[model samples]
Target: MAFDYDLFVIGGGSGGVRAARLTAQDGHKVALAEESRMGGTCVIRGCVPKKLMVYASEYKESAELAQSYGWDFDLGPFDWPKFQQHLESELGRLENAYETNAEKAGVTIYKSRAVLKDAHTIELADGQTFTSKHILVAVGGHPNVPGLENADLGMVSDDVFTMREMPKKLMIVGGGYIGCEFAGIFNGLGTEVSMFIRKAQILRGFDDEARGHVADCMKMRGVTIHTGCSPTEMEKRNGRIWVKGSSGHEEEFDAVLWATGRNPSTKGLGLEEVGVRLDRGGAIEVDDHFQTAVPSIYALGDCIGRVELTPVAIREAVAFHKTVFGGEPTKMDYDLIPSATFTQPEMGTVGMTEEQAEERGPTLVYATAFRPMQMAFAGGEERVLFKMLVDKETRKVLGVTIVGPHAAEMIQMAAVAVKMGATKEDFDATVALHPTMAEEMVTMKEPVRTLD
Candidate 1:
């Protein structure tokens, strides 16, 4: 069978770009199509830009803390325009890098949306068609916003980066990581932030204790969080966004941000016409090898709704290349993947939570909470949490969770230990570094609680 290319990738996201580059480098005819930017969500609007905003927001706290260390200066208001200019410049550099790498690998770039025409043929938005031995779908996902009264007045997470002016008062609806993170970001930037969550607490799927610690820290830092209620209707009045809550409370704010949820970007890709199976949430369903029901097609990353992290997408791409092109069979291992939430007191976790572990079998939990030296000396009430979950019979560390400063960095190191099936004794044998929050990971000798 004659084909225009050996592989035709239908997205330009992290997974799609990596798979396209790898397949082209393998001396296969490869082409990738993207409707908008090259670096997709992570580089353009999601992780990179969000983290930069987090950095910018943290400086106000840093500046205030400097006074305790004998530093003197009045920090001014946050300059969003100035920071946004720099952010756009950095994003441009990244998008160019993605293009350069793909071009270097001899992959043809199509700047249009591509959809499956048949099992191995793709049609683009601009009346172009290409046939390949195999087709890959990696379109990722998009923010999910419900249709409510004046909901269009609210912005999603993507809109936050491009906002023209910083709001004096911001209302964030939803309690997921995105909402919690932005609440901290805006609050630290001196915006009065009010978070509305329909649940009793934020971070629904995380460790309860860790979630509690972070929620407490956020409240102490002046974020007004409303739980057990959500916005039922919204309206604009006198230049302010008026939101009517489920609890019979009405509040007006300068801006309202919705981080409700996300849906897979699998619409109108002609998946159903080509006999590809999608789950109830419209996420493409694939087998263990990421192969669709049709032998010549495959899907992965956010479109599959497995793990929506950028690194996971990149890994999936690599595994896909090895399995299909490299003459080596590979299966992705999804165990013990560490993740972090960039909240005020950040959260990092890997493997199973205490609730998850106890549900499986007998488990032993070690937990500690204390004020860090820096915060203690500065007369701050801030605290750090370190917890480890171990299987009682195997004596293996099943999970690790940290809530406090540098939780993200510390959890990366802890992930290695948990992934290696290190036992409680392995941690105990590692000598503790004195006067450090991380030392708590190794120094918690006794079990705080045992679950039978």
Candidate 2:
């Protein structure tokens, strides 16, 4: 095939850049197009900046604890503008790194939106057309703000990163990871945060016990979490957004972030003209090989809605390249994908939840909740929880979830074990790393001490 390129990828975020670079590695000509920065939402506006802010916000609590740890403290007020400037600078650095790495790896980078011309062609916004043997869409997902009264007063998580000013009172309208994270971030930063959620608890998809622990922590930290509540209408009065709830309750806030959900960014990419199947949520329908309805095209990352996590996107990119151009077929396995949230206490989970394990068979769930040893002298009033979901019959570990300091770092190694089918013996056989918080995960006398 005399193709303009072997692979033409759209939306140069994590997934697009990975796919383009991997295709180029296989000696195939590849080009990727992006409307925004190369680092995507995670680096620019979402995870990366948010996590830094989380740490910064926690400094207030940390400083308060320092006084009890034999240290006199003189903590100054946080300058939001200073943090924003630093965040923007860091985003620029990461974006530049991705660009340089892509160029060095022989991937042509296009800075524009891509409109699909057909099953195998896309026209860049700049009026350049490229025909490729494979067209991969990695546009990712965007924050979805539903149609609500006074919607203009409400913002999404994306806009919060660029908030005009630090809000005095914030009302978050959802209880998902995005909303809960911001609730903790702003509350830790001393903004009165009120979260109104429709469900009985936040983090609806996570394990029930972990979710309960977070909810308890949130309430204890003075952030008001309203469950079984929905906003009936919203109005603005005297420079604030006034929210009316279903139970005839009313509240006002300087900002309302509606982190209800995200939908795939496939609306204007011309999917329908080429018979690309999309689910009810607008997620691209793909087979096990990640091939779309159109044989020559594929899609990955948030847009595919398989895992919707960042690492899963990277994994899909590798599998797609190996399958198509590298003369090897690879299918992505989503069994034990790892993920983390940057809420106040932090949380990380991998593999199946206890609810998910129950679907397969009767499961043995091991769990531990306690204060970390490091915190004894640190004077922090936080709890570290470690949960392991295992199969009672087979003794295979089904999942690992941790909520505490460095949860993300510790969970990754445990994720590898779960993915590789590690059992109780595997964990017991490994030696403890000593005096570290991670050692707690392995040294629990009983996974969960019961009242037997």
Using TM-score, give the best candidate's number. 1
Candidate 2 residue spans exceeding 4 A from truth: 378-380, 447-452
How well does model 1 score by local distance difference test?
Answer: 0.93
Summarize candidate 1's per-residue lDDT along 312-377 as a digit string, tens digits.
999999999999999787888998899999999899999888889889999999999999999887
Model 1 pairs whose backbones collide: none
Question: What TM-score does candidate 1 get on C-alpha atoms?
Answer: 0.99
What is the overall TM-score of model 2 with all chains considered together?
0.95
Most lDDT-accurate candidate: 1
Worst 10 residues of 1 by lDDT: 327-336
TM-scores for every predicted model: 0.99, 0.95
lDDT of each: 0.93, 0.85
RMSD of 1: 0.9
